[model samples]
Target: MTILTASAPRDEMSGAPDVRVVAVPAGHPYVQRVTDAAGIALLPDPPVPGAAEGVWWPPVALDPDWIRANGDRADVLHVHFGTESFAAGHLTACVEAAHAAGWVVVFTVHDLTHPQLVDQRPYAAQLDELVPCADALITLTTGAAAEVRERWGREAVVLPHPAILREGASPTVVALSEDLRVGMHLKDLRPGTDGPESARTLVAAVERLREQGRHAVAEIRMHRSVRDEIARDEVRAAVAGHPYAVLVEQGRLPDAALNAALGGLDVCVLPYRYGSHSGWLELCWDLGVPVAAPDVGHFSDQHDDASTASFHPGDVDTLTEALHALLSRHEAARPGSIARAEIIEARRAHRREQDAATATAHAALYRRLRSERAS
Candidate 1:
């Protein structure tokens, strides 16, 4: 059966039975990889005005004509995320139209930014409207699914995000030793006031690490969209007193570059003030980089494995303490070993199972929708 998948270009695919994924003009590597893996077809989606590069926005106007033209080619519609852009409108209409055309609609809720943040109220309402219309709903985390049920009074399947693991690929990059480097990843550092505060806390942690005579080099990497002077000033001020802290602004890099960057890092820190799930954290786990995250949202859900560390958000003292512990553990030859390998393998296995379940759930929804239509 053919399924139409709509989301950011990051999740697009190349070929899958009758599957066709809608992606932005310039898509993401992960999307390409998934498409290739599934052997799914790809449909190019027009860009949303003012959206950052590589970000997918559902187009505003729905060309029912275009969808109707292709409707017969697929039996199901699957969408990845929800937004307020025109692409979202078109995608929503496509789902409704697919349903009207006797096809099923499946949606995966990736972010729980809705009930937590007020600015997403309209989008949240739209999601509520869309969920009931979908034949099935999927979420990345159980906590997120619970929140969705609580808010929309609907049940959803819990499927964790897929990890970044390429089979049959030799290790092009080796892991960094404890004294080599420190790394922090930030998707965006300018949401609530907490964005800057998190950066400050990380800087403080790095400073504490330096003071302890640890020959560690801190590298803070962020996306290019966050190049505003205000955010840059905050970063500058945060690391102003620390000689070892270096801030780097980079555009999207190729997969090899990304893997290399991740490989050379001894510890990867995510200092988010609020958020339930983090794709970055998943990447860290997959790469076997020791992680230090704030224990607020989904970070609390993470297992207490030897390779991971958690701290309170916005608490410089606690974050510094955690960093110190990680460094000490690193120096004692405690971080790199079979323990880290085991954690990475377990997490990878779990993600693979989740991906398989997600694919199976979508297929099941398609069958159920077909049966309903026949009835």
Candidate 2:
């Protein structure tokens, strides 16, 4: 926790700058990736009981008492996730304590509706407390920021998610199978998943593609821990031993392993039935794999026309048509095809620029807020 270099007043004593941001749940990949970005050095969290090695969990920054006790360690408390961990009342108190500590509270509305919760009430309650209480707000896309303003009457800085994978010299060639490989990884059937419906839609899309003389296979992956859950069974039964569909059950993967798994596929179908934005989408873009996500969220707003395709989770026609379009677009860039390689490379270049821009924007925001708070 804490990004710290001294403030301007103290800069006379210290030469460099660091904002000292104590973000909520500092251990998530997205958070780690963002904080690891340009001019922001990573700091190891102080050990906590029950925390895994090199990982920070059950963030103490959420506690009002923690801020009161250690607020001097940070200049900003940037919250992107972990709304589900505390009650709205408690978060409000934490905001008050942060202000009392003279630290700016910057909140990023990462989720308008939390994916793990069946009930939206609690998520909304926490957002109500945070959106209005924080000194500054941030969100991933314009669609999300619009929702935040429409609901809370507050404007949030729109920050594009930085590329999860390192910027490469050139994007890997768009990988394609002789037949399209459509993958749906349902990790533990989070509440946002219409698991069974997603399975049904995939099966139908594959069938339609085959009937149209296009060869395609759908792979549905699930974790062994959720293998016996009702939704798990429902998802498995939805495919019903279809020939072109394969269900693979396995344990969780490390970051590098997950990237390899995703890159192996031609297209990844996001299983979430609802949510705000996706880090998975960004990951697919990084690997030169196209993504197909449910139309429910701001997923469409997160990518350009060719990088992502959207479809309803249950409606077979929409998914089938979306798949057709994605496949055609992919064929143009698939390995050995020179037709669209330059276009794809240009997109990757844009992603690299986006990463730098994102880092600069966050850096500028932090500095401006810090200067104002000091003044």
- Scored by lDDT, the top model is 2
TM-score per candidate, chains pooled = 0.74, 0.88
User: Compared with the true structure, what per-residue lDDT tens digits does model 1 show for residues 1-375?
Assistant: 123333322222332344444432215444343334333455555455697765565442134555577666655555654345433455567666776766666676765663234376666566766777777777766677778898888888765465566653212445435564778766445452254677777777777767777666778877777634687677767766667777777887676778667756778778566666766776776776777877756654444466667888888788778777776675433234555555556666776765554554444444555558769
Clashing residue pairs found in predicted model 2? 3-20, 3-21, 4-20
Cα deviation of 259, candidate 1, in Å: 1.4
Prediction 1 global C-alpha lDDT: 0.61
Which candidate ranks first by TM-score, i.e. highest? Answer: 2
Q: Cα deviation of 223 in candidate 2 (Å)?
A: 1.0
